[model samples]
Target: MHKLTEIIKYSYNLNLLYVEDNDEVRNSTMIILREFFKNITVAENGQEGYERFTEQKFDLIMTDINMPKLGGLEMISKIRETDNEVLILVLSAYNEPNYFMESIKLGVEGYLLKPINMEQFLVVLNKVIQKVQLKEKSRTYMSLLGQYQEVTDNSLIVSKTDPTGKITYVNDEFCKISEFSKEELIGSNHNIIRDPENPKEFYEEMWESLKGKKQIWKGTIRNKSKSGKSYYVQATIKAILDADGNIVEYIALRSDITDIMNQQKQLEDLIDFSIKPILALIEIVDYNNLSKFYGHKEISHIETVFANTLLQSVPNKKLFDTVYTLSHGRFAFAKDANNQDIDEIIDNVKKALHNVNSSSFEIDGKVFDISIRVSLSYGDDILENCTYGLQKIKKGHSDFFIANGLAQIEKKQAQSNLNTLEMVHTAIKDSKIISYFQPIVDNKTKEIVKYESLVRLITPTNKILTPYFFLDVAKKGRFYSQITQIVFNNSFDALSKTTKDISINLSALDIEKENVSNMIFDLLEKHKKDASRIVFELLEDENVKDMNVVKNFISRAKKYGVRIAIDDFGVGYSNFVRLLDYQPDILKIDASLIKDILTNDYSLSIVKTIITFAKSQNIEVVGEFVENEEIYLLLKELGVDYSQGYFFGKPEPL
Candidate 1:
């Protein structure tokens, strides 16, 4: 009680006058108030209180309504005439309706009755303290706000919006970042900051989190700054709340560190330059950075070492590229020469390098030993004008012979990839290719609703060759579109009568070709009835490399009502979050998992998970390799809606 009274006591330079006719009540209150308050005066009667209150410039006036002479109500009304900002409170029997109604016009902040409970008095007194502190805090906040505006007004982006996530106010920086001016963006959502490369999942996750009461969130954001310049920043978003605990606005603080990001990139490039050509069989796929493998400084050092060794070695008729160690003890390569017998070439070169090491180069301080290999191409490896056939030799492996550049098989495989391309081309020219069908069944209906048309080239020996034999090669050459169109036409002709839809996989390469869409639309127009019975199976192959192309193709394809199935679903590096972007009608689950769908719980779980995801996206599921009764039954039980394989039917002559 005492502490609360002391805290509420006035401390300003303005005058304070307290009136209480009771001697004890007046004396104690005056002493406590005077201890913390300045310019204090007391009046025994309402008359004196009014006189003193009018005489001085007071900030607060407290009095009992039951006081003598002029009475509290009359004194208060007179005081109200002189001041409005001054806080007024009644401390006596002030519960009467008339007294309150009249005092209300006097702006009394609080009123307490006679014989006040100490606890209630303390609560009311603390409220007065709060009011004073609130006024002081408000003034301080205003001053700080001015300083804050000065510090960040020019650099930071400031935006204010109503509770609904629409933009209401945007500063210069916000306008600069979003490229939309205050006028244009005021009613827009914050999506203008979105980047093309950003995955959809991040936004989905963000919105999900934002809907909750989370105060702030941290995430790496990629946004297009006003001038269509993309930048990355670590952003923190905070929700500004009102007194009722409802979010009224959101503030985003983003710092541009594009230079720091670029420096990090350079540092990564430097690291790659130092330790590449790892000689280890681990696949490194940072699709953004591939040229780092060609380490200029290290490669040059290796070349010099090999060059010195070549200079010292006795010249021979067999031309070969050779590498020798130098000052850094790092060795590299034999330059591809015009006439190098690459086979005997590597051995003689190694011998020459060894000879130089033994005779002249010293065993220097902390020298690193090095091993290298060379490759050879003689007959078909050579193009019509070119002479030698060594495509590439990896200076790696457990095979010591390979280290010594004597791996005959390494040279043979290079010969095969080169030979395979020609063989595939010759096969296509000869019309050895045959169309095969992989029945695509509706798992829910347990029937073949579609057939995914596959292309195969059967050798005269009756060996069935998969499309892999020629597709990659054909895609590289100009023959892909012809083969795709032929397959499409053949499949349509084969299924012209059946109610079942025939899906044909067109290489994104086919769609990218000139007149592909026109040709398809023309073909479909000729077979409008047949086209509805067809599904153009889309694969995220070459098209996935550029999303805009894929989106454009799908958007155009969708207009034909032919239904699009994402072929080899969940098998590629497609962003699953953006799966909705393609809006596929069917998700042809990849055969890699379908091949053993039943026995492996892991594969079953994955298929089930994909089905659940696809269901949400309104995509039908199709199983490819339903080879046995058990597999078929298991997939059906596991909620797989489709089954197609030897168990149901195989591709036979139409």
Candidate 2:
């Protein structure tokens, strides 16, 4: 009774068309139709029904198999030529299988007897309503998904593999980053780009998480390009599961973090290397102040001429092995004090500075007199001592300074770090960690659909600070997880009061921690009704230590109807194969890509590809950093489903 009532309610809003030549039969059926549908167009014959269909759209059409001026089957056949989606029903006295077969061939929704049965008619009507409603819902969902896929595919490195780990599909980003053509990757094993430096144990652990445990595998991976050039990626690998929960294939989503990895390597190399003794630090006195009189280009030219003069003025080039350019118009000349005493090396550098200070430097078309301050230091910690002596020269009325021992620079640095650590501790203890809500708008509708929760910290002075200021310090002090907990809890509390969905940012490290994961699960259980509205945005900046843990959390959260979104996708470290494990509901395109989409061809191409892939997967995409009207409209034209940034509104307290 409930189902029938619901069907009748749905039918009320639907427009239907009825056609019959028999006056008694048509009038009787019209009574039944009028009961369910208010807007029904009655046609006397097949020709009239066809004309009514052409005039306006109808949800359901009922006609007799045999009718005058054109049979009912003939009218339906004509309607099928123009429209394939409308529901059709046949009502006739013909009991033969030939009539039934012919009606079926005409794509009739149901074939009833001359005298309609009330129960039978209602049941058939219910089925038709279900079909109509399902199709309409599917269409809307796919349209949204298509837009998201376009944005996601363009921003991330995505690829898919068969059940046995054979490459099957690769997006443009995957090929561009890996330096392999689609043709080369399609039939090859995933190991084609694998860097041998990654030990066998690494692969073992990854497979154990993905294949054996049926979980996601995430980690930083070193891979070789097609030309054998090494590159690094933060990878997420997962097994794609079928409706029956069986493993079907694999997908990997990766972000290219090669530049970040290289930078880290460079910093480590610099730290590991030994500094040369007998260092001389030289700086153009009041170099920054020179910007007041000269343009940046002229100032730069002046610095270049001064540096060249100092190098050329050196009596013997062998005295200084290297000349290092430091910031703010400073240079460091360093060499070993093996056989030559510190005094001798210092004297030689003194001669170079004397000659440079006395010379008239020509920069561009102007000649200017340049004076430099020199600091000389030897023995252990030559760099630090020379730097300290330079600072003294800048303050005091002196052109020269010599350091005999270590300065208090290290102590000052230590004190600064300690101060930052103390600030982090105080913030955490006072429950100062909070989240700000940024509106995410639908591209087409230009309306706010959801809000992304951005983490912010309040200082002791009550000033709000973004994560950029103190997040790393908090991590160093082991308070990073606490901040995540605070933000997650606050976002859920916000979700309770609002009808719109709220997205909370999270990283793999957060999932690895038992306490954080436990809190998240508990919250979902505590607010079961709001679970459907909560979105967890997985941050791709950090590496995942255990893919299984993250995957398990995702799987569990999904059971509560919580959605997962990949945050900052396409800037780096995305894999399509890994998407299978995470199966994200949304992909938040990195701001870097979105900001440059109009000007950068690569960015536009990447966004388009992401949207295409997202459409196929039925995932939504949220474009970040939509700062202006032009960008928002372009995203809509490109079929991006949602957008987020300052253009709609900056992050604010909700």
Score every model by TM-score: 0.43, 0.42
In candidate 1, stretches whose alpha carbon ends up further than 4 angstroms from where it belongs are 1-306, 309-372, 375-392, 395-433, 458-478, 515-517, 572-574
The TM-score obtained by model 2 is 0.42
Question: What are the Cα lDDT values of the candidates?
Answer: 0.60, 0.79
lDDT of 1: 0.60
The residue-by-residue lDDT of candidate 2 on 247-358, one tens digit each, is 8999887766665465444433443363545667788876745644553335545666666677877888777554655545777676556667666777788888788778
What is candidate 2's CA lDDT for residue 274?
A: 34
Cα RMSDs of all predictions?
A: 28.0, 24.3
- State the lDDT of candidate 1 residue by residue for 1-654, as single tens digits: 247446544454446677889898887677656655677778888899887876776656778988768888788887778666667768885455466545555667656555554444455555555566677789887876765565454554566666677887877767765677788888887776678788888877776555563447767677886677888665667778664446777777554545446644543343344422111111111211221222223333433444554455635634423232321122223333335445555565456545544453322232423332323222221121011211222223421122323244456755776666666666668776668876767666766777767787766567777877767766765666677777777777866657788888765655654467677777877887667777877776633445666678777666667788777885541233345456788887888888867566545645765776666556787777778888777778867678878988887544
Deviation in angstroms for 188 in model 2?
54
| After superposition, candidate 2 runs with Cα above 4 Å error | 1-341, 345-407
